[model samples]
Target: MTSTHSRARRAGFAAFVGTTIEWYDFYVYATAAALVFGPLFFPSDDPLAETAAAFATFAVAFLVRPLGGIVFGHIGDKLGRRVSLVITLLLMGVATVLVGCLPTYADIGIAAPILLIALRALQGLAVGGEWGGAVLMSVEHAPEKSKTFYGGFTQLGNPAGALLASGVFAIMSRGGETFIIDGGWRIPFIASIVLIGVGLWVRYRVEESPVFASKVEGRKQSMPLAFALRANWLPILLGIGLLPISTGGYYLATTFATAYATGETVALSEQLILDAMTVASFVEFLVTLPIAWLGDRWGRKNIMYIGLVTSVLTFAPFLLVMPGRIEPAVFLLASLVRVAMSATYAPIAAILAQMFRPQARYTSIALAYGVGAAVWAGFSPWFATQLIAWTGSVWSVIAMFTGMAVLAGICTRLAPQHSDEAPVTASFTPRTDTRTNRLP
Candidate 1:
């Protein structure tokens, strides 16, 4: 086998497993927020208010994500993607494990929730860097003809992590009411200890991106964040717009949907919701690769358009079924929504990397995705509940989802697509004079 192909394989595998671990840590918090965080940490007179407060803590991480992006983006751009990624993985793992060990409101009063939020903030910082670097590692190392397919490896983390989180929680939930409330949820959070070792081992094995290594010499920006904003602000804005359905909307389906179903709004069983989500997550894991493969043939934007239209149409139905008392069909809808979501999620790795010139690609992609996630995914559940509290109708939340979908579709149509230019490729040579040298 050729050296390039072998390196790409290692990079792709590292990206896949590393992101799975990072996202697994992230998803555990989301699931806990929706299910048990209120009683364990927030503890309020009004259940709805308690749920809202729990979500508020969940949103805290989003607030910190943009800052994390800038700090690590600079590191990735100036130092290397692999260096930035390893630090992120370690940081996230430590924070998540700490969260599993945190005391509840009953144990330490306000300090309990305070510590929880602090740890979550640290997680936000780690993830903000992890994603942009992971995607770049996979996409940049890929052969041009199969870039989308390889990019899908990084995207694979979302569903795989979600699957692991949901599945683990499903098992924990089986311990019954006494077990779940007592401390069952903590098990999933703590179990992540094992994953960290695996993530660290695999991430360290991967080589640096060939593209970044070749182009990284004198091309780095002194202020990559500032330069990215000045030069490629339009694509960055469009990139943020393009992400609502994939990031925030998916959270809506998983986080908010689970919360709403179990709460007084729909009053569905928690076990049922967790079970359905497990099935849906498994289905999503299965489908992401196929959809990404299709992106290679039909164009990433076109596949995203397909995902947008389907997700928009399904929003109301997906919500409608929540209150309708459907059985396994709820899982079916969840899987279908995720299938549509995969169209957007899987292809976006290649899309975002291609959108930016390699000059400040790390910073540009990180900043754009961080902001987009903060705006969209961060507040989706909180806002959905607020809308319900104000209007006394779930339709308001559905309307918001539809609105974001419409905006993303328009951005997908308006945004520019990237192409590989052979003329530019042969002219540039890899910088190898100093293997350990970095930009000043």
Candidate 2:
């Protein structure tokens, strides 16, 4: 029992650190796109076009993320979670390190942005692969009574990573105007090398899943993806549906909020908005564990349902009132959005992992999550900005938020659960014979 407890601690810590590195590498690109890439790689006479071009490169990773999911899911499902996770860390680190070495447009003309896009694509692919393996490692290793709490470590990486990326740039910005505008952005991308090294070291220490260990003889699917598509497709769809609230909801709170606060309509200081996000990210990091604990005791789906409903109700008021005020109080109130996000985000690891049989859990969860990220997260921020541009109101974006919450709530209410209490079965269908595996 002590050994099992020790292993669970190691697994949770590994997931947290690995995901922190992966997300830090990914978010550094987002931060750089906003603050540096626009000026460097896509230097244009029109600032709008230049900004658009930089963001397009940022979006490229999301486009290829699903491909990464498919390829890496195959690796994790067939090869083992640890192997896929380590490879993903290496891939993301290498690409991020190369981005630091990349020549600017002035140095290499079109090849600069081309290479930038290629590196970003690699980052997307690596992260797409990384998430599933990390999530599985933690959830599968955890005690059944506390899977959500352990799983929260994976979700905890988001804000922790965002904070690191944002903090790195914030510090780098002080290195004088010439360094910042000319080349300092490379520092964060390059720093990924060190972060990945640390992640690899930590990830190496954790044991492989016993559940995965149990799959042998006739138990293992020869083609996990094929089996996932055939028998577990409903839960996969539900997973995708339930994810918009997380993937998109976060973008709404952070990226879109940044755009709205800094854009012409409100004209808040960029520094104010970024600082607010930094604070909110910290709050989210603090908030996730408690929500996950609650899920473990009460129910993962119930916590998620309440969170989605609260977010649906609060999102409009958040946009219309608090954020519009442009005060520090805005973040204090908006932190509740993070709390709402935690409801779904914290327990999602256990929830999604349990949705399908272990034979295809990695593939199904990874693919569905990749799709959700691409559509909801990758597009939602840009989409929110466009709605404001087209409709001249943030209310339209708020409506979109409400619509997503409704969809997620309905899906969560209906999703068939596969609980940690059940043994990993060869069959892809959820095991309803087990009382704990039944959806409430």
Candidate 3:
């Protein structure tokens, strides 16, 4: 390979590893909150209410992600990508480990739920900052021709983290619910410490993205959030619309499925759900890289639009296939389709990363992405479950996913085809750091 290609590959691999570690910390909670958090931390007389509360708690983390992204994006744009990554990794790892140590409702009463919310919020922030840093690192370092592929490589981290998170949960479940609630869940949370260390070691070794480096050397945005809002309001709105489709789909597919299965006894065994998720993640991992590669030849928007269409078409069948009883065949098919949507968007990091000049890309993309995710994706699982409870069918939830995906496509299409090539006249620089580094 050419030297530039090699550098991009190395950077992509490192970003991939960092993303995996970052997401691993984030997703472990999803598994726990769905399976054990309600019983352990939010114990209540009504099982149904308890589950709803647990889902709400899960959504809380997402609510805080926008602020986290704004803060981290500022740091990445102004300070450096390397520093932003380091702090984000440390924040996520520390918060996750703390969750492992938190006292349950049995021991701490109301404080248990309070602590859970705090930790979840912390996690949201950590992750909110993470995506921008990791994606920028990979996309900036990538060879111009293969940038999307590198972005896809970094995106692989999602499935990698998801697989590991699900695998851990599945293993713990095999030991029995008592074992999981008592101590098993802690294993995954505590594991974050080790991942943090690995992520830091590699992250510190890399240089900042050349694009970001050049921007910093020139003059960084003083207020990235404000600049982004003023200049790219339309992109931000479109991005937000799309966020619910993917974010909603992800949470609903993983957490909601677990809840539905466990409650109805039709959901696959914990082991089975874990296995299905693993398979889906593995498929996602395999497909994401190629999708990103394809974007390079075709266009990032081309691939994403296709994925959006797929999401719209597959929504109903995906849910309909999941019945009260776990049908391994149906489960696999549904999970694979979900994986396809994820895979299609795998290269989107590079697409979004290129949307603005390096001077403002961090803030513009970060704020837009964060707002989209927080408003749409953040509460998706909670909304879906609540809707399901209300309507007694999954049609509404499926429609929501399909609708958002279509909207995202339209919005994404509205963005300039070559954002990196776009001329700019204005920018913003943050006057002060807004990040609250408190970990749960």
lDDT of each: 0.85, 0.80, 0.74
- Alpha-carbon lDDT of model 2: 0.80
Question: TM-score for each prediction?
Answer: 0.94, 0.92, 0.91
Query: Top model by lDDT, which number?
Result: 1
| Worst 10 contiguous positions by lDDT, candidate 1 | 431-440
Show model 3 residue runs off by greater than 4 Å.
Answer: 265-267, 324-326, 419-440
Choose the strongest candidate by TM-score. Answer: 1
Positional deviation of residue 335's Cα in model 2 after best superposition, in angstroms: 2.6
> How badly does each model clash, as a count of residue pairs?
0, 0, 11
User: Over the stretch 57-112, how does candidate 1's per-residue lDDT look in tens digits?
Assistant: 99988888888889999999999999999999999999999999999999999999
Give residue 251's lDDT in candidate 1 (0 to 100): 90
Tell me the tens digit of each residue's lDDT in model 3 across 1-440.
Answer: 58767778778888999999977887898888778887787778877677888888888877888888889988887788889888988898889999999989989799989988998899889888888888888988876667788888778898889878988887787897578877888999988888888888988888767766654556766887776777777656655664555566666667776776666535556666677777777777778888888877776667777777776666566567666354666567656676667744685787677655566567667776777777776777778778877888778888777777767766666654343322333453222111110011
What TM-score should be assigned to candidate 2?
0.92
Task: Specify the poorest-scoring 10-residue window by lDDT in model 3.
Answer: 431-440
- Local error of candidate 3 at residue 124 (angstroms): 1.1
